[model samples]
Target: MCGIAAVLNLSLAPVPHLRPALGAMNRLLQHRGPDGEGTWVHPRGVAGFAHRRLSIIDLATGQQPMTDGRGNWITYNGEIYNYVELRAELGAQEFVTTSDTEVILRAYARWGADCLTHLRGMFAFALWDEDRQTLFCARDRFGIKPLYYTVVDRMLYVASEVKALLPFVPEVETDLEGFKDYLTFQFCLSGKTLFRGVGELPPGHVLLARNGGVETRRYWEVYYHPDFDHTAKYFEERIRALIQESVAVHQRSDVPVGAYVSGGLDSSIVAGLAAERQGPGFKGFTGKFSLDPAYDESAYARDLARSRGFELHEVDITADDFVGSIEKVIYHLDYPVAGPGSFPQFMVSQLASRHRKVLLGGQGGDEVFGGYARYLIAYFEQCIKAAIDGTMHSGNFIVTYESIIPNLGSLREYKPLLQEFWREGLFEDLDQRYFRLINRAGVLREEIKWEALGPYSPYATFQ
Candidate 1:
């Protein structure tokens, strides 16, 4: 991914200092794109856009903050994986560059904000519509890339990371409500961030700033419309086809691509499919801890690499390495995330960066497939409750007690979580029960200032 930053004078007048401040913001994200850097201040000095470019698709000319001769300019991060098809559909002869960035700009020029519907990729971008004098900004549908913005003195500062907005903000202060949300749910709900006054542009949403006013509206949403009519075999075939097609499209790149093979089902499947398309020279990276055999999974990665005829690189993570890099890692992450997984993931990413500019992994598999231990724990309690209440045949039940009996053994290892979740929410509604299952705030209640956090229920927000 590249990095993008913008400064918009909501007053609709000149802000001389903003042009230099935009350059400084892009410098903070230099690590994201060391290949190139560019900045542009609107002729009227009302806005400025900057880009840190990591050339991926078109290594020769994929520079940014690029513009169309008609006065539209864009500073974009992430790729449009289906750009080739989109370019063909948009009439390839009209474009000057092979870069996906141009495709996005032209798409917007033709379709306006409706252009978001035609794009199929991860992106967070800000485009200046010179004619309308509007700054149109959007984050991708899944939030794979980040876009943060905060309004200061009616001047809006937007960047790929919060650190870029530091110099301009009044002071670095904690957002108490966001902190409380993080304490309760390990993530902030809505567009909240730990930094006071800064808000993330939620995925599938667009932001338009003009004439001293900012407006945001959702452009897309993921609705669960279950297909009850389809047979199991039909779904299986569709899923397989979708996965193959997804991997094929993701493999589009001008540079060699690699995989992060974790020796697990999801990553293994991704690696296998990528290897099939990548052929003999594919590279795979894995990280394992040498402290215990149970902590290591590199052997499985080796086995897959051997069978798939791909080169495998391994890193043995140690306590010393963690100690050395923990501070840097936390600094880069801005705030703490879920767990210790980020540490190893960082190590493996460092290993991969040595050989490849792009690497694929199976990150969202667990969330999509309900593979997390908490899901099983919560569902196990549901099964027990259903059996006791004689709701085995309830129309709302997705899995009956009998169907889940064989998997009950998995709960044995999650006894602590089961205890915490069931202690208060037994026989409660699903939303309340699931809320209890994920809540991590009880242990820190004494340390929090309730008044500062305000009257908010994370559970209510979650629902």
Candidate 2:
């Protein structure tokens, strides 16, 4: 991964202090890409791009803010795992560099915005189309990479991190709506960020800026279409194959690759498969809390690493470490988003960074596979209700009481969450039930001024 920043004068006037501003943004993001740095200012000064390259691939030649010599230029971060295939499909002869960045520029030259559909990896990038005098920007399908932009006085500022844009803003202020969303879900929705006027580009979306006007559009989305006709074993096999394929592509890198293991199913499986593919000398990292045995899970990580024949590295995270790093964590994060776990994860990353530039983890496994304890807690309640109402076999019930009995034990540690979740809504509308399950605002209601946050329904948004 790398860092990218851009400044575009949407009014089509020569941008003021283009070099200094862009240079500042690049300097602010120096940690993202330490290997090299570059900047490009359009001849007319209407557009400027700055890049800090991590040099993960094509280490010698993959410089950025690169141009196609045909009036197109791109500054990109993140890998295009399938770029090798895309290169062949796009006629490799046309590409001069061995970097995915060049592949993207070439793809845009041939397909324009549709080029996003051909990509198969995490990325956030901006491409300047000299012919059309338009600045085109996009985030990957899942927003796996960061892209934030703000338009102030007909000038658009974009960067991988909010801090890069802070210098340009007249005053540092919180976005009330975004703060409310954070209070509710610990994350903002609809492209809102904690910074006033700044917007996070949502997953699978594109933005175009030209002539002082900007428009954004969704290019792709995920939709569920269950296939009842297929047998359970068939779907299971397909999922297994897909995970294998995904891991294979994700291992494409010029730098050393490693995995983060939590001793849980998701990370364990990811690390196990990665170890098998990487063979000997593959490394695994784990962060454990020294405060309590309940918080420590390094044993599981050790077991997995030993079984898989990979070296296990552990970081004993102490309370003092958390207190010491909290300010820096909040600064880099822009604003608090996730829970306290983010700090430990940050420490783990720092540990892994010493040995490897690329570390794969099962970050999305819980969301994608419903692995959260709350899922079981919610379903366990539903199972009881369905049994009592004699609707155990109804289509609305995904699992019968007997079928879900074995999973009830898993909810033992989540009793507090279950207690809070069931206190107000007992078998209510599914949406309302889920909203209660995830809502964090209740805990801070007394401290928060609801009126100041304005009127909005996080529940309705959830629905």
Give the per-residue lDDT digits (tens) of candidate 2, residues 40-119: 99988989999999998888789999999987889999999999999998999988889999999988988988999999
Query: Which ranges in model 1 have alpha carbons more than 4 Å from their true place?
Result: 394-397, 447-452
Per-residue lDDT over 1-463 for candidate 1, one digit per residue giving the tens place of the 0 to 100 score? 7889999889988875976798799889998898999999888898999999888988887889999889999999999988999899889999989999999998998899999999999999999999999999999999999999999998999999998988899999988878889999898889999999999899999999987799888999988866778787999999999999999999999999899999998998899899989898899999999799988989999999998989999999999999999998998888879888999999999999999999989999999989888888777778888778877776655666666778878777878877777676577888888888888886676687777778877777799
Residue 287, candidate 1: C-alpha displacement in angstroms: 0.6
Q: Considering summed lDDT, which 10 consecutive residues are worst modelled in model 2?
A: 394-403
lDDT per model, in order?
A: 0.89, 0.89
Q: Give the runs in model 2 whose Cα sits over 4 Å from its true position.
A: 381-398
Candidate number of the best TM-score:
1
The per-prediction tally of clashing pairs is: 0, 0
- Compared with the true structure, model 2 gives a TM-score of 0.95
Cα RMSDs of all predictions?
1.5, 1.9
